[model samples]
Target: MGDAATPLADTRRWLERAVIGLNLCPFAKSVHVKGQVHYALSEAQDAQEVLEDFTRELEALVALPAPERDTTLLVIPRGMEDFLGFNDLVARAERIVRKRRLEGVIQVASFHPRFVFAGEAEDDVTNYSNRAPYPTLHLLREESMDRAVAAFPDAAAIYEVNMETLRRLGLEGWTALDVGPHA
Candidate 1:
């Protein structure tokens, strides 16, 4: 197994440079600042293994108080590297959450080095917002998420704003961030 430090470093950089620096997720900065995000590495090389890791993480998250750990970014640095395969794992992870009877309490957001939006070109700059150096599953507490969304003004417009933010950055600028697939 690899040192947890390496993955944590990479994940932290991605959160700062891509997610925070790019303003991809507005709520991210606050949670990050409060040290509420848990960065965990999953040494899984297959879909089932990844699912197992997801189950473990979910249980841990729900077992603790929300203030202790508001969210978790389960970093899968190996396996399911392909966007489609990573997406499939995400589906299975969601089902596992539901089967575990933790559906509304927690939810998942997906990130991949090759994440692509439907109908968007493979090289589209906007998709870079969701791209990370590895396949990552963002485990969120639904209650906290709902509260954050409610408190944030004009939450519904976040998507449109993010799209425009990427366009302004352009592919060249995104490449400069050095946290994309190739990085």
Candidate 2:
């Protein structure tokens, strides 16, 4: 497996490239519609601090004027939360969005680590034949992207995955469940 530190960054860069390459023209119209990364807090004490930072950054981003009429806000979550905590956060965010009148603009996405192998053939060729097993890299699902994009109509969502890992998996269109952008 690749070093943890660089993998995430590398994944993010690849995602940026993929989005650009897709040429989803509508998303490109608004300056406010951009990707963001967030890490989950490890402790209750850290929540406030994390929230404060998020709020500040979000406020600043929202304040900026967009050349287009539509704007999309993407929120990426980094940690696990109990059902209660998750509901609470969602409720609070909903309230905040309503209060700010930002519905249909702001989108929240949660990402967890996942292993993606290249399709069976590649795995057989590389991992089976090689002395060492092939590495499984973290990947986000297209379902997660769909959910995020649906929540925020003006936004597009994507999960971060290692390109190398995907190449190894040999996954093709429809193999990964609707690989294209959400309609």
Best by lDDT: 1
> Using TM-score as the measure, which candidate wins?
1
lDDT of each: 0.87, 0.34
Distance from true position, residue 34, model 2, in Å? Answer: 10
| Error of model 1, residue 114, in angstroms | 0.4
The lowest-lDDT stretch of 10 consecutive residues in candidate 1 is 174-183
Off by over 4 Å in 1: 1-4, 181-183
Can you write out model 2's per-residue Cα lDDT over 117-165, one digit (the tens) per residue?
Answer: 3454432322211111111111122343455457665552222222333
- Please give, for residues 45-73, the per-residue lDDT of candidate 1 as tens digits: 99998888888999999998988899999
Question: Can you give the TM-score per candidate against the true fold?
Answer: 0.94, 0.36
